[model samples]
Target: MPYTPRKAYVVGVGMTKFDKPRGERDYPELGLEASVKALIDAGLTYDQVETAAVGYCYGDSTCGQRALYQLGMTGIPIVNVNNNCSTGSSAFAFAANAIQSGQAECALALGFEKMAAGSLGSAWDDRAQPMEGTMTQLFEIEGDKEYEVDDFGPFAARIFGAAGQEYCEKYGATWDHIAAISAKNHKHSVKNPYAQFRISPSSADVAKARKITREVTLPMCSPTSDGGAAAIVCSEEFVKAHKLEDRAIELAGLGIATDSVKLYEDKSRIELAGADMSRRAAQKAYQQAGITAKDVQVIELHDCFAPNELVTYPALGLCAEGEAHKIVENGDNTYGGKWVVNPSGGLESKGHPLGATGIGMIAYMALQLRNEAGDLQVKDVKHALTHNIGLGGSCVVTVLKKAPFYKEGSHCKDRFGYDFAREERRMTQEELDKVRSKHFSDYLPPSVPESKL
Candidate 1:
């Protein structure tokens, strides 16, 4: 008999506000905020979690233990993950696997990052860098070309920037098209309270912004951010036992893929930037979920750079190859078009906090499926997809849908009137008190005016 995987659902999700590195709270505080909020959303407590997977890129060994210690050290098995930018999604995948495999009834996936206040770089120069192969491929492609490497911006900018240049040369894309992509994401961020940069810019403004690399401007790149996000994964039995059908979001399909031979062998710089990995992962996820890109109503893809977003459109099967630029020009990637891509402002505007980004996408998708995204809500959303990538390299694509068993007259509806936004606020104080009282006895709830409540 073929192996059939058990089902898993996301019962709760949350995140701390994304901010510039060293702007505010520590990793422990950020992690605690998101974890507590997720538990509250799920109507669960820390003790109920049987296992956990925590993700981070720059941190000491066992940082997961230190960060999660704020929630309460229940002695659950904690797995540490670091898969570059895809760290958070990798953590989420691990938690989901635990639930699907019957290893845990309830599992937690938490991701946080406290980055340095500049472009990302290697922590150690003593040994071979992980991106050596990718850099070698890039050099091979640029042989005889005299390109000035930007000392101030991230090396990733050049990689994706070159890919954008390649697309323009191979197809008919232009700098204006890439600027439009950036403008769209920035505009989308205006409504997202949790985003790091909420200032929407015009396409012209984006094109004129400080240049980071070849045709890549400042607004085109994701800023280094400090934040955290979390999701609570549970089995069908657990959701039923807790009577959480109304709030549950089914993890319909998840796919993860790494670099293929194409990365080194192909002449396409886009392929080296993990486009093939994204394509493979998306294909697997769509196959597992038995749905096509046409069925997806919303998407939160890794727009680490605007150029990457353009390249990813075709990789995710959103459009035909070599026609991704056409979709942008046709308004098919935004609202009232084919799909609302990156309604959470994406990594470009929402801010990529490395490990937090993947789970953050999950949080956004879950809210959209629950119809609780507030101003960022898309219309009549049925299924949502998320794409998160880490170069050197891995990609994870997940499909989510509203739980089938959920009914109109459920607990969420009866108690909160199905207003997820309001429910999130009303429950925050109560849950904070519950958590603090169990751990920190002297903790006091922040006072809010009755009018706001």
Candidate 2:
């Protein structure tokens, strides 16, 4: 929360097609595709960026340097961030804060991931697990309850599934309600060209999908994905200087919160899974934006699992406490409903690459505000909210709206020389060259070549 007289705006955004991991591409190619496209979307080159924040969950130190050097060797600050699932938005927050603090008039926030196939696992094994405390808390809560642990699914399933079970217990929500959410997201992804899983399923099919746990099913989770997404954040001065008024989406409010006593003292599985963290962060963002959750028309939350999305509804103040089921049953979370949640299919259908996921949320919302989301666009969306969280844990809540000077579809034709928002097209070498730094290097080749993935 760096204070500044300047307001931050998202002037550019880009995302690669999310795919199931095939190991065909490395992080550099994925990272470069997103970075280059974002630069092109801004109608700017790499040299103009004063600083950069790059995020990824699994990579060596200096990966950001490796990723950015492909654009140029200007030697501006490049920070590498790893905040688990929320890493992408954390990088974005850092970039926005720099603009707000006047440390830089413009900054680049980039997130990329080249994840492996299957469930998320620990990269380090010899040390104490960061999630060990959560496991201890979970066991304490399940004392004498004789539930069998499924050996097949990732630990995250158990964590969120237990919390979802507790939520149902407190509020009398049937598991069908949770399965409906999965079905909705799966159906929504059908129109998203970049989604990894676009096949639609019925609520009954999702509920009957192979059980990950007694309380969790296969379609109820986000699959591991490989992709990259990025945003260009700049100060109001920069936007005016560049005549980007029409394209800029205001970074109206942002709040990041970590674990509190609620995690240890509440004894509520809902709170244990970072719902309290989500609430605190959402409240701060809402207060800053001068908008309530009731005013939100669109939302892109961290639906790493359907249960996560379910618990997050109340946590984000979208509904009253213990009443998330009403929103699901009333059809308020989909198109023609009160709010469109995850029109981009959510993590459940869209795929989740930890670092890129958060920035992807911003990319989607920014498109909505600019009226460029095409068939998936919500009607008349002026204000949007996003909630990204990680367990062990941190949460970043953001409220974004159309900038005062925003004009629908302005600069769309000039941006990337086509309607990129409506279509997910791979960038050409010509397009990449248009945004490369004037001070480009030839001594060493970029980490990734100017080619397709």
Candidate 3:
């Protein structure tokens, strides 16, 4: 027997432009802006929102309440959610689930972050604690020495570097190829009015750019940003009563999973814990949406670092176990690939405002489904997916399907199937030309030659 589908629809979405502002707005102000805009987009008033789920990684106490106060006091319940990088998506999941569970007919999910908090390290890890000894010594080994880079950076670096090198060896991908993915995001971002870094650089430019610190560069990394995004989610009955079926973007699936924070804890775990969670999430999403991976026309993966995409590509089954890099080199992850990834420029260039990113991804995908993405819109986006990974590899995957998918109960089959090599083989020079044409020469490092491919 076939399973009955759970129906939850996203009716309204809103986001502020990501800017590297000279002065930051308070979380309340940012949240207020997003909240008002979301209601406006949904064609509803504050009274219609049965509950509010607000996501923020770093904010003052009572931040959500303070923000809601800016709007007239509504006695409705307000749920505050914090899950590091995945906070936004987690909040969205909660709102959708509440609607599905019959807890509420209409709910709001808001994700807001401000640069006043600083980068992820200073924002979450608290470097000053180690210096003050309030926290354990940086890398002290039972009254011994301190570990230089400590846990997050070194652990992430080892996993990213090792996996990247392995992918390079297995599929003939080069550092140039990896760099190209960053270039692709930046190039696409140049067209996005709301992206923080709206400038493009060639692969050679990124490869030879001066390092800000280690392999990271001003261009290669997303800027610290102050921004917010919000979504209004409601039940199918509410949508129909309000005559909002056209605006309703259905939720097909949601998955959340975690992995060990320590890099060396599980040697056999080739995929991050979040990857496994995302895989399971995808399986459920496919079953619910009645579509396979190939049916997805666009995707937005958690690209906090370029390497995150490398690990995620295979885990999401876009490629084989260790060949995501090849997808980049062949330009299959670009504008007109089998499935376009990160048309919103992704975290690498679009900006990673932590709590805002998950909602931001969904907003962009919804725009594509509605054919309102302008230049970034892929052709015929029937099904789209957003995969966001948080600190220590906490993962959340959400599946979205366009209208008319529910009534028919049709299972969309994979046109390309699970053949990674076939996809790689189809990569052509013409595909590379489109990327090259969008390149901006100013972003290149002085040392690198431009003509060499």
Candidate 1's C-alpha lDDT? 0.86
Tens digits of per-residue lDDT for model 3 on 53-95?
8888777656776676545455678888888788899889888
When 1 and 2 are scored with TM-score, the better candidate is 2
lDDT of each: 0.86, 0.89, 0.67
RMSD of each: 3.9, 1.7, 13.5
TM-score of each: 0.92, 0.97, 0.79
Worst 10 residues of 2 by lDDT: 444-453
lDDT of 3: 0.67
TM-score for predicted model 3 compared with the true structure: 0.79
Residue 311, model 2, lDDT? 93
Clashing pairs in 1: none
Residue-wise C-alpha lDDT for candidate 2, range 1-453, written one tens digit per residue: 954457899999989989999998788888888998888878899988999999999899988888788788887999999998999999999999999888999999999888888888998889999899888888788775676543345788888998899989888998999999999999999999889998999999999889986689999999999999999999888988998887899998999999999898988788889998999999999998998998999999899889988999989998989889999999999999989999999999999988899999999999898888877889989899988999989899999998898755555556766777556787777876777778756554545554463
Superposed by TM-score, candidate 1 places the C-alpha of residue 248 at a distance from the truth, in angstroms, of 0.9
Clashing pairs in 3: 139-147
List residue ranges in candidate 1 displaced over 4 A: 146-153, 409-430, 435-453
How many steric clashes between backbone atoms does each model show? 0, 0, 1
